[model samples]
Structure formats: structure tokens, C-alpha cells
Target: MKEFNALVVDPVGLHARPATVAVNAASKFKSEIKLSYKGRSVNMKSIMGVMSLGIPTQSEITISAEGEDAEAAVQTIEEVLKTQKVIA
Candidate 1:
């Protein structure tokens, strides 16, 4: 398993646009990826699940992946989040 933490930097937080980007990114991987916030965790590939968390600005989030491409999955998600300015 591989995991990394990030702080949401977007003023609007992880809204639909960023959440869609994240779900799209996670769907490309074969690994099981999860996003966690405020003690709740959801499948990163599911936009509904992610949005359900209602992650807000400055919130700490944990992304974790398990399986063959765990490391790559986590890295890709981290990059996507950063590029989208959803996290720093």
C-alpha cells in the first residue's frame, strides 16, 4: 500500500470540478484508491463518494492506494491534486 497526505488549498474546497478530476485520475489505475477526510473515507474513483465528504479549504486529506500500482496511483493522484490546485 502507498499513501500520502495533502492540505486542500482551493478556496472553494474539493468541489465538483476538482472532484471529477480526481475521480478520473483514480479510475485509470488498477489499484484500489481511497480518499479520506475527517474520519470518513471514500473510493477515489467515485465522484459521489468523494463529494459526500464535503471537504473544505484547509482540510487535511489522505489518499491511499493498494495493489500492483499503489505507488504510481498515489503519485498520480498527488500530482493531479496539485495541478488542479485542490491541494498543496
Candidate 2:
């Protein structure tokens, strides 16, 4: 598995827009990607799963992927999160 932690910087936290962006990004990968916040973890490709976390600003989130494209998946998600200003 490949993973990285990021601090959410968005004032609204991981809301619909950014969550959709993340889900869209994760869906492009074949690997199993997950986003973790607090003690909960959910599939990164699932919009409902991601939004259920209710992640807030300054919260630390861990994104992980397992399978052939694990590294690439994590990297892509990191880039997406950064570009969306969801994490810095």
C-alpha cells in the first residue's frame, strides 16, 4: 500500500465539491483507494463514503491505495487535493 497524510486547509473542509473531485480522481485508478479521517476510513471513489467522514479544517487525512497503481493513485490524489486547496 502507498499512503500520505495531509492537513485540510479549506474553510469548508471536505465538502461536496472537493469530495467529488477526489472521488473522480480515485475512480480513474484500478487500485483500491481509501481516505481516512479521525478513526474512520472510507473508499475514496465513493462520494457518499467520503462525505460521511465530515472532515473539518486543519484535520489530518490519510489517503492510501493498494494494488498495481497504488503509488500513482496516491500521488494523483495528493495532487488533486493540493490543486483544489483542500490540503496544503
Candidate 3:
């Protein structure tokens, strides 16, 4: 498993637009991606799970992935977050 902490940088947080981008990026990985905040863990592929966290701008989030492509998954997701300007 690989883990990284990222802070939400998007002005609107993980609402509809960014959530869609996140989920799409997450879907490409074979690894099991998990996002956690405030002691709660949510499935990365589930939009509702992500939005339920209410990750506001500047809030820190932990992203972890496990499986064959865990490293790649983590890297890709990290890039996506950066590209979307979703993480700080």
C-alpha cells in the first residue's frame, strides 16, 4: 500500500465538477483506492463517498491505494489532483 496526504485546493471543493474528475481518474486504476478524512474512509470510485466527506478547500485528505498497480495508481491520482488543481 502507498499513501499520500493532499490538501484540497479547488475553490469549490470536491463537489460535482471535481468529483467527476476524481472518479474518472480513479477508475483507470486496478488498485483499490481509498480516501480518508476525519477518521472516515471512502471508496474512490464512488462519487457519493467522496462528496460525503465534504472536503473543503485547504482540508487535508489521505489517499491510499493497494494492489498490483498501487504505486502507479497513487501517482496518477496525485497528478490528476494536481492537474485539476484539487490538491495543494
Candidate 4:
């Protein structure tokens, strides 16, 4: 497993459009991806699961992935976040 920390930078947080982008990218990966906040972890591919975390701007979260493509998946997802300016 690989782990990394990031801060949610989107002014709107992880709701609506941002949430959709996160879940869609997560679903495309074969790795077991998880997004964690305040000790709670959720499956990255589940839109509702991610939204339920109520991630707000400036909130720090941990992302982890395990499986064959874990490293690549994490890197790609991290890039997506940066590209979308969702998290920093």
C-alpha cells in the first residue's frame, strides 16, 4: 500500500462536481483506493461514500492504494487532483 496526504483546495469542497470527478477517476483504477479523513476511510470509487465525508476546503485527507497498480494509481489520482485544482 502507498499513502499520501493532500488538502482539499476546491472552494466547493468534495461536493457535486468535484465528487463526480474523484469517483470517476477512482473507478477506472483496479487498485483498492481509499480516501480517509478524521480517521474514517471510504472507498474512493463510491460517490456517496466520498461525499459523506463532508470534505471541506483546507481539510487534510490521506489517500491510499493497494494492488498491482497501486503506485501508478496514486500518482495518477494525485495528478488529477492537482490538475483539477481539487486538492493540493
TM-score for all predictions? Answer: 0.98, 0.98, 0.92, 0.92
Superior by lDDT: candidate 2 or candidate 3: 2
Comparing candidate 1 with candidate 3, which one achieves the higher lDDT? 1
Kindly provide the TM-score of model 2 when superposed on the true structure, using C-alpha atoms: 0.98
Residue lDDT tens for model 1, 29-72:
99999999989999999999999999999999999999999999
Q: Which candidate is the best by lDDT?
A: 2
Clashing pairs in 1: none
The C-alpha RMSD of each candidate to the native structure, in angstroms, is 0.5, 0.5, 1.0, 1.0
Which regions in candidate 2 have their CA more than 4 angstroms from the true location? none
| lDDT of candidate model 1 versus the reference | 0.94
TM-score of 4: 0.92
In lDDT terms, how accurate is model 2? Answer: 0.95
Error of 4 at 1 (Å): 0.6
lDDT of each: 0.94, 0.95, 0.87, 0.88
Question: In model 4, where do residues sit more than 4 Å from their true spots?
Answer: none
lDDT-based ranking: 2, 1, 4, 3
lDDT of 4 by residue, 1-88 (tens): 9978998888987677867787898889899999999999999989889989999899999989999989988888888788888987
lDDT value for candidate 4?
0.88
